[model samples]
Target chain A: MVYFDNAATSFPKPDGVYDSIMKAMKEYGANPGRSGHKLALRLGREIFETRELLAKLFNIKNPMNLIFTFNCTESLNIGIKGILNTGDHVITTSMEHNSVLRPLKVLEKEGIELTIVKGDYAGRINPKDIEKSIKKNTKLIVTTHISNLTGTIMPIEQIGRIARDNGIYYLVDAAQSAGVYHIDVEKLNIDMLAFPGHKGLLGPQGTGGLYIREGIEVKELNQGGTGSISHLLEQPDILPDRYESGTPNGPGIVGLGAGVKYILQEGLDTIRKYEEELTKHFIEEIVKIENVKVYGPLDIKEQGAVVSINIGDEDSSEISYILDENYDIEVRPGLHCVPMAHKTIETFSQGVVRFSFGPFNTHDEIELGIKAIKEISKEL
Target chain B: MVYFDNAATSFPKPDGVYDSIMKAMKEYGANPGRSGHKLALRLGREIFETRELLAKLFNIKNPMNLIFTFNCTESLNIGIKGILNTGDHVITTSMEHNSVLRPLKVLEKEGIELTIVKGDYAGRINPKDIEKSIKKNTKLIVTTHISNLTGTIMPIEQIGRIARDNGIYYLVDAAQSAGVYHIDVEKLNIDMLAFPGHKGLLGPQGTGGLYIREGIEVKELNQGGTGSISHLLEQPDILPDRYESGTPNGPGIVGLGAGVKYILQEGLDTIRKYEEELTKHFIEEIVKIENVKVYGPLDIKEQGAVVSINIGDEDSSEISYILDENYDIEVRPGLHCVPMAHKTIETFSQGVVRFSFGPFNTHDEIELGIKAIKEISKEL
Candidate 1:
């Protein structure tokens, strides 16, 4: 099957990732940092080396500032819940995954003020709009680096400058950009960044992390044994141990390290260039098909690999079903967990079919995918 | 290496667990519940099946009540932080892991009243003492099924009955006892139960779960997109989705399903009996050595496989280092993330060396471990 759902999670990960997980479980499966034995200490060092790799990839200064989480959603929750408090104003865009929008709404109900700037029809957010939304009480400016629904890349660097100019904390949700596109947290002026290792990093599921800048503290989201301060009843006041509160997914983290090492070896530019060619070819060919309407910027440079479209008001799930069963091509359907983004694109009730590409996706697969959609459009 | 730190995390998971994880990743690593496609739907079904297997093992009537977490510590945080409020009273024992004790301390500092009853010298807690500590405003009664430091089993059935009799919420942290011992939540009058999959369940690390009884709602600890309520920003008030807000550890959970299925087939009594024999024999031999002092009830019927001891006035870490470097045996020497339990056992600053056995441990390995400890004591 030709899988085009990399936006949800990348499939067919680098071979080293699977091997690393198996090696971790079979050779040294002991709990890291929870014991004083050789295997446990070795596992702990493996975890730290992974942190260093991530720090190098993201231009983070201190590796200890990175905290491993279960998923990008959990990282977002920890950032959103840890930093914001009552009566503080937060600025965000209408185009965001429910991971960002839901937590803000929960906080808004509890008396936090919110300003949601609208993204254009092409799902692009203006940096000036974010700056204009700021108020004296504004404590944060958070935006998704790339819209998951339309793949429109936001101007996070410009927004980051605006946040710095205002002395407010800037957070970039890097769910769609971590390993696919280059992210230098230090250069981008981003104070907090959340990313999923399973996606662009090509790691297995259940591996993700949050990078919090020094001097910023979010209230602990989940608290327990960090394996550091066992003598104290209170959670330790350390870089990651303060925020991280349990036995980390050790095997998953090791696999993630392998994935990131592959990325570093392959070079981010090479991987991004490959996916870009497939995405550009897809958009250029598919728009000529009869009665098909596409969303987001048609320019490949302005968007990530995600492409959404509909066929003459056909329900997206129905087309996706036909594509899966008859055409043997897997594409996602529905709102893609960004309902507000769908409303902005005018596909609120009838969601659009999403075709996302990965680094390993070939030109042949994209050609087959376009052929499948052309056939589906004719039937509709 | 002879691994004897199964309480930290069981090593060499029963053969099929690693294979199941690999199968999940290679065949269908799609994001479950986030889209409507063949792979995603199949994965969602697989996750549901895993939940059913866990429910069957714990005697839970509703499979949806079991929510998978990163570890048992995350489960405990979700339970403790979710159920308590300011001005409410909570009763707990001193022989609890920091997973339970740390969260309670955080809550206590936030104005929640706390009463920590002391365990006896043998690490046993009297049920009447717990009942006497209850107050009119008591909202939660939480305890560990077995102390991590000493392996002393708590009177959870009696405590569960008391909490039920008083209409208080009862939570059991079964980190050390799950999968190796029988735990029927319904029969024990348990309102909530937290367990780790890596310990006795023989799954990989990063897999654990919490079972909340029907009709009870704990505020969500981590909130984000659950895919079902995409139209609304507020978190959906659903069973598993309410607490589980992120993309789950699919491969790990599938591994956990295989692990739990193996336990169900092997019979909990058989596994418990094997570990019991190892623990009983280790204690019987180790105590006869010079300058060795063991903690916990000597009876195998009253404890788990965790055995803690120290050579007279010798730092446990030095001996553990010797054990690792010279004898190639793995034993944990530290606070074991349960300082209160260590304090109760009179090993606060001088922590004991912990040698925990698993079902796979053989009589010959125990004999070797005993000989190694005897040699270390002679050097002391």
Candidate 2:
């Protein structure tokens, strides 16, 4: 099947990731950092190595600041819930995913003040609006690197500068941009970054991570055995252990390491270029079809490889079903987990069908997908 | 390697568990419950089927009540922190794992009244003592089904009865006993049950679950996009969705379903009997060696397959290393993530080496492990 749902999860992960998971399970699947045995120690080192690789990729100086999580949702929840307290103000954007928006909404009911800056029709958020929303009570400014619904890249670097000037923590949700975008956390002054390993990272599901800059403290989301300081009942005051409290997804993390290795070897710029070519080719052809309207920044350089479109007023789910059953194409429909983004793009009720590209997607697949969409549009 | 660290994580999972994970990853790795494509729908059904199988195993009438977590630690944290409030009282045993004890300790500092009833040297808690500790404000009684450190079984049946009689909620941490032991939550009056799928269930790592009885409400541990109720900002008040946020660990849960299927086909009673025989044979032979002292209840019927022993006061880590390096037998030493249990068994500083048997373990491996320990004991 032609899978266009890379935004949901990148299908057909890089070649070595699956093998790495199987090898880790069979060769050294012992619980890491729990026992004083060779297998446990070896597995523990492997996890640490994965952390180091992530740190290097994100320009993080210390690897211990990266905490493995089940998904980007958990990482965002931890960052949002751990930092914002009662009576504190948080600044976010309309382009944010539900992961960030939902947590902030829950906190809003608990006396925390929330200000959502509106995104433009193209789904891009102005950095000046984020600065204008900031108040003396504002403690944090969080925004997504790229809008999942519109694929419009936000001005996180400029917003990060504003947050630093205001003495507020800056959090960037890189769920859509982690492996494909050139993200230097230090250059952007991002204090916290949350990302899913399965998407652009090309890893399996059940793997994600959060990178917290040093000197920033996020409250422990869940307290339990961290395999460190077991004698003390209190959660240990350590970097990663304080935030991580469980038997981590060992094989998943190992596979993530392999995925990262592949990305590093291929270079992020090269992969980004290939995906951009596919996105540009598809958008350039699909826009010529009658009654087809596309959302997000039209320029490939400004947006990600994700493009949302609608044929007349067709229901997104129904269009997606036809694409899958009749055309052998896999694309996601509806709100894409970002209800607010649909409202910003004027597709709240009639959601747009999304076609997202991955590193492995080719020119031929994009052309065929466009041809199928052209046929579907004619029928509509 | 002869793997005797089943208490940590059962090694060489049931035959079909790994294959199931691979199949799910290749065929149905789409984000379940997130999209409307055929792959997503098929995956969502697979996850629901897994939930149904788990419900049958635990006698849960509604499968929606069970929430899948990254591990048992996350499940215990959700149950512990979700229920207890300030000024409320909670009763737990001294033999509980750190997963339960650590969360309760954090809550204790948050103004919850915590009463840790001491257990005997045999690592068993008396149900009468638990009853004596209950107060009018007592809201919950938490205990581990089997101690990770000593393998002594807690009388959850009597504790459940006491909690019911006192109008208190009873939570059982079945980390080490879920698959091998028959746990009828309804029959035992268990209000909540937390267990790891990777242990006796013989699934891959990164899989575990919590079952909340009908009409019980526990605040969500992590709140984000649950695919359902996406239009609303507030977390949807739905079972499974309410407690489970983030992308469900699809491939890992599929492996867990396969593992549970194997257990159902083989019969829990048969699996339990085989593990019991292994435990008895290992214990009977190990006790015959000079200078070897064992902890926990000596009776096989009253305990699990895990056994903790020491030789002539030698450091447990040293003995475990010798076993792993010289004899190729994998065993866990040190606190085993249960520091309180070690203190209760009088091995606080000098922790005991733990030998936990699995369903695949044979009589020959146990005898060889026992002989290796005996030889090591003679050297000491």
Candidate 3:
């Protein structure tokens, strides 16, 4: 099947990912840091090395500042719940997926005030609107690097500057942009960045991380085992250990390292260029179809590889079902876990079918998917 | 390598588990719950079926109540943070792992009071101590089913009955006992249970879960992408989804299901009986050996398969190193991430070598391990 759910989880992980997981499973499956055996210690070193790699990739000065989490949602939650307090105002946009929106809403009930900046109908958030939404009580600004629903790349750099200038922390949800885009946290003034390793990084699901700037501390979201400070009565007031409680998903993290290595070797710019060319071809071809309305930035260079669309008189789910059963193409349906983003595009009621392209996807497959969508529209 | 760190994580999972993960990877690597397509839906159904199987194995009422997490730490955090609040009090024991103690300490700093009753030097907590510790304001009483370092099994039935009598919530950290012990949550008055699927469950490293009793609002631990209620401005106040955020580790969870099946087919009770008998024989033999001090309950029926000990005049790490480097016997040394328990046993500064056996371990292997330990003791 042609997999187009990279937004959910990229399939056919980078070649080395599964190999690394299997190798670890066989050779050093011992609990890292929990045991002192040679294999166990080796496992611990492998885990530490992966964290260091991730830190370097994200331009984080200290590797420990990166906390391994289950996925992007867990990473974002650690950041959202860690720093946001009751009565603290947060600036966000309609471009966010449920991960950010749900946590922010929960905080709202706990007395945290939230200011949601409205974005363009295609899910683009203006940096000026984000700056204008800031209140004196605002302590944080969270915006997606790219909207998952429409694939519109937000002006994260401009927003980051705004947040830093206001003495507020800036958090970029790099779930969509981490490996696909160049994110220099230090240069971007990005205080906290959360991302999923499974998507653009080409790692397996269940691997993700959060980058916490040196001076910022979020309330511990989950507390348990840090594999360090076994004698402490309280959670260690350290970097990753403070937020990461419990045994980490070590094998998955190793796969993440492999995925990152693949991306780094291939170069993000090259991958971005190929993905843009494919998406541009897709957009140009799909727009030729009658009564099909596409969402997001028309210029492929301006956005990520996500292509969302609604065909007149056809429900998104119905089309997705036909595209899957009749055609061997797999694309995600509904709001792609970002209903607010759908509302921004005025597609909340009907949702939008999403075709998220990855490096493994071929142009021929896109043609097949487009052909299937065309057939689906005709039936409707 | 002789891996005695099974309690931290059971290394070299049952061959069937490794095979199962590889099979899933090769057959249907599609992202589960991402699309309504057949492959995606089948994968999603596999995840739900795993939940049902887990509930059946544990005799739980609703499968949906079992929420997947990254590890036992995240699972315990969800159960703890979801159930308790400010001004509330919790009762636990001194033998508790850092997973419980650290979270409680953080909660205490947030104004939640707690009473940590002491465990007997053998790492046993009295049911009466738990009873006495409960206050009128107490809302939850959380304890471990089995100590990771001590191998001691608490009197869960008695404590569960006490919690039931007081109408207080009872949560069991079943990290080390889920498969090794046959526990009916309802019979144990267990209102909530948290555990890692990777350990006794024999799954991949990333799998874990938390089970909450029906009708309780488990304030979600993390927020993001629960697919449902995309239009809602708040977290979906529902079972499972309220706790499970982001995309799940499908391969890991599926592997967990496969692991549980491997146990269920063989029967957990039978496995428990075999492990108990082995533990009894090994403990009797080791206790007779000179210059060795054993930790945990003397009776195998009341403890677990792990045997923690130290040779006379030897630091635990030294013994562990010699065991691995010379004898090729794998074992864990240093504080076992539950230093609180070590303090109770008066081994706070001196960690013990921990040898934990899994079902796959044979009696001959135990005899060989015992012989190896005796030889190492001669050097000491």
Candidate 4:
């Protein structure tokens, strides 16, 4: 079966990832940082290696500042809620996933001021609009590096520059951009970055992380036994431990480290180029079909591997079902947990069938996808 | 290697658990409950099956009420912080782990009153003490089913009854008691049960759950995409969706299902009886050693598989190190993330070497642990 749901979760992760996870579980599956035994210490050391790999991937200087979370949603919650307090203003764009928008909406009810900069119909967010939305009370600016629904790569470099010049914290939701795109957190002037491991990173699920720049005091969302400062009832005042509470996914993080190692060895740019080729071929051919509407910038230069399309005003779920049942092509359909993004792209009612490509996706699969869309559109 | 660190996380989970996780990852590790494709639907169904299995194990009528979390600490944080608000009081016991205490302590600073009932030297909390601490403003009563540090089994049935009679929510931290002990939530009148999937449940480290009784309204700690009601900005007000956000640990939950399935097939009572035998043998022989001080209610009827001991006032970490390096017996040393429990057992200064047995542990391993303790005590 052809898998096109990389935006949701990457499937068939590299063989090394599976091997590393199995080895970690069978060999030293002990809880890391909780026990002091050899197995526990080994697992702890391996987990730190994962943090280091992620730090290198994101151009983070200190690995200790990076914290592993259950998923990107939890990371976004901690970064958004931990930084902004009551009466503090934050700026974000409409082309973000609910992971960013939902938390901001919740905080908005709790006395935090929020300004949502509107994105164009193609889900493109202008840094100038975001700068105009900023106010004196704006302490933070949040935006997704790439729109999950439209795959429109935002001008985060320009936005980051604006935030840095205005002395505001910039938090980037690199859900779609991480692993498949270049993200130098330091060079981008990003204060915080959240990314999921199971996405483009080719790691197992249950693994994600947040990178906090040095000296940023973000209150932890949940306080618990950090394994350090077990004597104190209060949470530890350490970097990762202050944020990470309880038993982490040990083998999962090992798998994530293996995934990063694979990416580094194979080269992130190489993977991105392959996926871009697939995306470009799929979009170029599919848009030529009759009565088909495609979303996003629809250009390899501005779009990631994700492409959203609707055939003849058909229900996105129905088209997705036909693709799954008739063509054996796996794709996600509907709002994609990004209602505002749907609104931005004018697919709030019709939704869109999202085909997200991974490194493993091939030109052959893209040809098949184009052919299936052409036939389905002609039949409609 | 003899793994006696089950309290931290169960190592070498039943073969089926590993197989199930591997199958889910390699075969159909699609994003569950996110997309409508066959792979996504299959994974979503598998995850729901896990929820059902855990519900059946816990005597929860509605599987929908069970919410999967990263770990028991996240579950406890959600249960404790979600239900209680400002001007509300919470009563907890000293035998509780920091997962329960730390969140309550944080809430205490937020104008929420916290009353920590002291446990006896054996780390046993009197039900009467918990009952007396309840005030008109008492909204919740939190307790651990079994002490992680001392293995003292508290009277949770009695405490649950007290909470029920007092019209307060009862939250049980079943980190130690979940898979082995019997927990009929309905019969015990438990309002909420938080448990670690990695501990006695024998799942991977990333999986844990909170079972909230029907009709109980608890505010979610974090909000994000629930995969249901994607059009609304407000978080979905559903049973599991309200609490579970973002892509879940699909393969991890599948592994947890395999674990609970193993428990069902093997019989929880039989597993508990085997662990009790191991505990009994280890305690009986180790207490006979000179200058060896054992903590907890030594009776298997009143304790769990965990036994904490100190050899001749020697530092617990030193003894633990010797046991690990010399004997290859893996155990947790230090406060065990339950500082108050250590203090209650009067081992606050000279911690304790904790040996927690799992279903897979054998009598031979228990004997080996006893021999190591005796040899260490004699040397001391």
| Residue B266 shift from truth in candidate 2, angstroms | 1.5
Q: Whole-model Cα lDDT per candidate?
A: 0.90, 0.90, 0.85, 0.93
What DockQ does every candidate get?
0.83, 0.77, 0.77, 0.89
* Candidate 3 lDDT by residue in tens digits, B299-351: 88778988899888689988888888887878888888888899999888888
Selected candidate, larger lDDT, 1 vs 3: 1
Tell me which residue pairs clash in candidate 3.
Answer: A82-A218, A82-A219, A99-B224, A225-A246, B2-B330
Backbone clash count for every predicted candidate, in the order shown: 0, 0, 5, 0
Candidate 2, A293-319: lDDT as tens digits: 999888887899999999999998889
What are the runs in model 3 whose C-alpha is more than 4 Å off? none
Fnat per model, in the order given? 0.80, 0.69, 0.77, 0.83
Best by lDDT: 4
Residue range with the least summed lDDT across 10 consecutive positions in model 3 chain A: A217-226
Model 1 lDDT, full chain set? 0.90
lDDT by residue (tens digit), candidate 1, A45-116:
899989999999999999999999989998998888899999899999999988999899889999999999
RMSD of each: 0.9, 1.1, 1.5, 0.7
Per-residue lDDT tens digits of candidate 4, residues B29-139?
A: 999999999999999999999999999999999999999999999999999999999999999998988899999998999999999999988888889998889899999
DockQ of candidate 2 is: 0.77
Q: Any idea how many clashes model 2 has?
A: 0
